[model samples]
Target: MLESLLDGIFNGISIGSVLLLAALGLAIVFGLMGVINMAHGELMMLGAYTTFVVQNGFKALGAPWSDFYIFFALIAAFIVTALVGLLLERGVVRYLYGRPLETLLATWGVSLILQQFIRSVSWQFAAGVGVFCLLFFGALWLISRRPDFEQIRGKAIAIMLPLSGAISLVVSNLLGQTYKFAVTLPWFGTQGVDVTAPKWLRGGLPLGGYQLPYTRVFIIALTILCLFAVFWFLNRTVWGLRIRAVTQNRSMSACLGIPTQKVDALTFAIGSGLAGVAGCAVSLLGSVSSNTGQSYIVDTFMVVVIGGVGKLVGSIVAAATIGIISYVVGSNALAPLVEFSPFLQGLLEFFATASMAKVFVFALIVIFLQFRPAGLFPQKGRTVDA
Candidate 1:
């Protein structure tokens, strides 16, 4: 019984690590930029794909080196996703700043586009393309109705065209999801791949007559490293100072000659890169797929929300608490309760199922929020106002 309890706690910590990782990125972007990035999960998907590519590259190279590919895969995933994040920020996200609703809608569209791009030509692409063409030609149609090419409005279409391409790219990628994009380059195949943990992390460790899986230990260690690195970067670096300044007050930062726009882009990229790292860590535990990131997106959001947005320590605490509670309630460790009473038996039986466990968890969160609406750790000053 003691072994079972210990094992369950270990499993909970593993789950918590992933939640912490996913929530960290969400906290950074949502807190600092005030942009609820709907496409964050897709960024994670990009990282998983990067790992898949790296793993395959090593496989093709043949033999012993393949075992060590995870290290390279982690770096590649962060870089690729970070670059993509920069493009996203410059191209679409920057314009939508200050308009939270618009930004949410726009990022949601971006997420659809990315998913479509991965899966192939789908309705999302068609809708995206249609929206672009409509906006593009809609301007011309208006100009034709007015019949003034030299008018200030006539040249507006030219400016709009460049913006239209961004929309079209987003939409086309969505539509392409219906057909599943076949533009396979080197390393990354056109489909999902199974990824197994390295041999070093595959076994178990004996402890006082009980054993703990090495994979779980690796997860805990990785989470610690990530937390330490983020803590150091945010506190010890000049760029981190600039970022904190911007987050505290964008207008004041700009007035002080800080490149607020650059900071925004970099922050988004770093946040996305963190998500990418989360994806790589996840790939070690499960199969890598286009949809892999989607599974954790909502849960991660809940973590950020419950932990109090932008609070790192709060996120850590919330993730661990939630992970443990959810795992414990969902596991059969509570089976002994069935012998106590019929009512308790039925209740336990209901929650023992995986789906109900989530519903129960969310319901608890809802109830908890009613008492403490600001979450575990609310941000002060401007963030509170925002």
Candidate 2:
């Protein structure tokens, strides 16, 4: 039972990491730009699709590049979505910025357009072995051709985001070595384990009756490292300072020589990049799909709202809280009731079959909003600023 509980906790943390990545972007766009991006979820969908494409590309090319495709997809999704986001901001969102209602309606329309486009292009292409090699090169060229960052602080944050993830991996490896921890996957029906720890740390330490997986150790360490990096970026960096500035007062920052337009574009890009990384992480756990982002949209936004607007700290708190609550409620509280209650069980069984847990959670957020109008940690005295 204790082992099962530990497994659940591990799963919850992994899931929360993905939510944190998705919400990080939404929080920045919504809080900083004061634009409620209804299509934010679709941007995430694009990222997941990018992953799917890259994975398929590897298979089609017969390249030994499956594992590396995750890295490529992260870069590709960020570039594609960031460009899309910039165009949306410049062409549509910018004009409707001050008009909140129109912005909402227009973006909702944009979302539908994107969804239909994805649906229309759902057919698979089976070209010759190396047909897409040039296309991949072209995509890389397009990404690199983006204009240089005008703001120093913006450039700094752009560099730091990925660096933070790398640093986390390193720290996780180091800690694994000191503790003699390793991650192993069971192979076939063999008694021996498949040691999958980083090259530097290959041995395992026994705990109780079972050997703790080194992957779990790495995950825990990485999670802590990501948490630290997030805190530091928000609190210690100059770009972080600028991000906070714009979130509070865009016009004022523009007047103070902040290159408000550039800031907006970069902020959107950084947020989108974070989402791309999250999608890559998701691919590790399950099959990637065109609609993967749709599954997490409601829950991720709830974390943003429940964490309060424009506050990174709030996001962290909200993510952890919602992750624990949802996992506990969804798996333990609801599962047994549906299993044992006959009539009630049948009703819940039907709902469960339809994946209504997502809808139920969305409804709960709406109900909660009615009681706390500004959300859990709303920015006080600044409601009228946007």
Candidate 3:
């Protein structure tokens, strides 16, 4: 009985961590821009693909390097996804600002395009894209940092985009000649690829006479670190303050000399980059495919909505609440009490399964929102409140 309780709790926290990690960026992006970025999930898919590319690169290097690929994978994923986010924001999202419906339709199209794009391309092409986005976004970031260079930013970008693309193509083709990653699937294909864990992180840890997987523990720790980092950035840094200011009152922030557009672009990039990090973490647990992000997209959105848009504390509590409830309902947590009664036990058996658990969880969330539509932590700025 005690073991069941402990196990369920551990699973709940780990599951919640994954949900929270994925939702963090979505929360920020949705809250700040009011743009329903359907491509947010696709950005996550890009991160996973980036990690896979890094993994293959490490494999080509061989031995010790291959064993420690995850470190590079995480960084690469963030950079690649961040750059993609920047491009998406500058190209599509910015134009559609304050128009949520159009943003939704546009991003949804982008998401489908991204998924289909990956599905049709070779890993090498994908790798080249990852490289191109990284270099290009880095160049753009440098340009953005220099206020005096704003006049030439357009020409600079026009030159850099093609230059970076050419360089990435050459680089990926050169690397592809040495070693190649191949996939085969006749119709729908096989399951996705899996990421191997390094030596220190493999195996399980014993806690309260129960075994806790190291991956889960690492994920939980990563979630906490990410949450702390976000909080610190939003509270402690200059850019963070600018982001908060812009999110609250875009026009007011702009009037105050804040570069609201740049702030929006950077904030969107940060959120997308976090999704990339979540992808890296997730790859350690199971297979990753184009559809990987689709699985969590809806749930993460729910997390953001339930916690209140743009509310980190709300996200934390909401994710934890949903995670624990999902786990408990799925497991035989109520079986102990109903064991003596066959009728109740039979009824519990019907609902205490993974599929049924989700139904109950969703229903509960629906009911909760009925009572508090603005969520646990509603926005309180003059612009929002008004």
Candidate 4:
């Protein structure tokens, strides 16, 4: 029993790391700009596609650096997604500042457009080269209609919050109760599992009679490294200081000759970049797809909300707490009891699936907000005034 509990903890940490990465961008964007970015997950999807493209490109070049391709994909994904974020800020987001609900609808439309575009491209590619070319041109034409920078940066943060939250819920529900894996190996052929991965990346680390996968360890290390870097940036550098200033008081920072517009752009870029890195980490854990970002979106928002918007410590603590709790709840030891509880039993019947657990968790968070509107660790002093 104890052994199973420990295993669940390990699984939770791994899952939580991915959630932390996905939420970091959403948190910063929300805390600073106040936008509910509905398109954030699509941005992540774009990053994943970027990785897929890079992988294919490498294969075409006859390069077999699968291990190193992950790093390259991360970099490429960041650059592509950051540029898209910049474009989004300039084009659509700018006009909708202060009108959060409108921004939500608009970004939601954008997300659909992105998904459809991907679907079209995927299907068209399968059809032939000519159709792919037509679709590519059409996508370019559509993207050319974006707004200006001042407007985008102004509204970007404000529009990301609810957009991110709602989409997360939808995603959680869609992935309910099933774990699917598609494993491929150089040595062995493809196989299906509840969860899939490369052969070398599978298996576990020996500990007594138990074992833990190397992938889990990598996730923990990567998440820790990312969190450390984020903290270091927030605390140590001139740029970080400037970002803090803008986050706290945009007008005052503008008065101090801080190049507030540039700062906003850079901050958006960094946040989006972190999200791209998160997408890469996600790809390692599960099959890369358009909906992948949806899985972690709810938990990510929870981390930011519970941690206090824009608070790093809050995100970290909230992420770890949620991870551990969800893990314990999902484990065999507690599953039966949770399933038997009258209230939870109703919920189980309502959701009746493991995947919907994320939605339930998020629903609980919304309820929590009703009581503690300011969050678990609201920013203090002048730090939160912006």
The per-model lDDT (C-alpha) reads 0.80, 0.61, 0.85, 0.68
TM-score of each: 0.81, 0.65, 0.82, 0.73
Model 2 vs. true fold: TM:
0.65
lDDT of 3 by residue, 1-386 (tens): 78787788788888899999999999889865577999888888888878887888899998889888988898899999999999999999999988888999999999988887767666666678789989999899988888868798889889999999999989887767766544221111234766777777798999877778898999899899999999999899999999988888788888999998889899999999999998888888888887988888898899999999878899999998889889988886878877789998887788798889899899998999999998999877553311
* Candidate number that wins on lDDT, 2 or 3: 3
lDDT per residue for candidate 1 within 1-386, as digits (tens), equals 78777766877777888889877878788856778898988888878778877888898987787888888888998899899889999999999888889989999888887876766533554566678879888876777786566685646876888888887876666555645543222133347777777667788889766677786787788788888988898899998999888888778888999998898899999999988888888887777766776788888888888888778888898899888778877885676746868888778878976678888889999998999777898876557213
Best by TM-score: 3
| Candidate 4 residue lDDT tens string, 226-303 | 878878997899999998888888888889999977777777777777777777667666666656556556556678
Model 1 residue 91 CA deviation (Å) reads: 1.0
Give the TM-score comparing model 3 with the true structure, all chains together.
0.82
Q: Which one wins by TM-score: 1 or 4?
A: 1
C-alpha lDDT (0 to 100) for residue 123 of candidate 1: 53
Q: What is the total number of backbone clashes in candidate 1?
A: 17
> Each model's number of backbone clashes?
17, 3, 0, 26
Q: Write the per-residue lDDT of candidate 2 for residues 1-386, one digit (tens) a residue.
A: 57656655655665565667667777777755668777777787666666666666765665456545655766787777777787788778877767889988998788777665565431111111123434443444544566653434455546554554455455544544554322211111112111122233334446655554544444345446655765677679887787778777878988898887777777766666656555554544455444566666666777788778776667777776666545544555355535656887665544452246455555667788899766777777775246
Comparing 1 and 4 on lDDT, the stronger one: 1
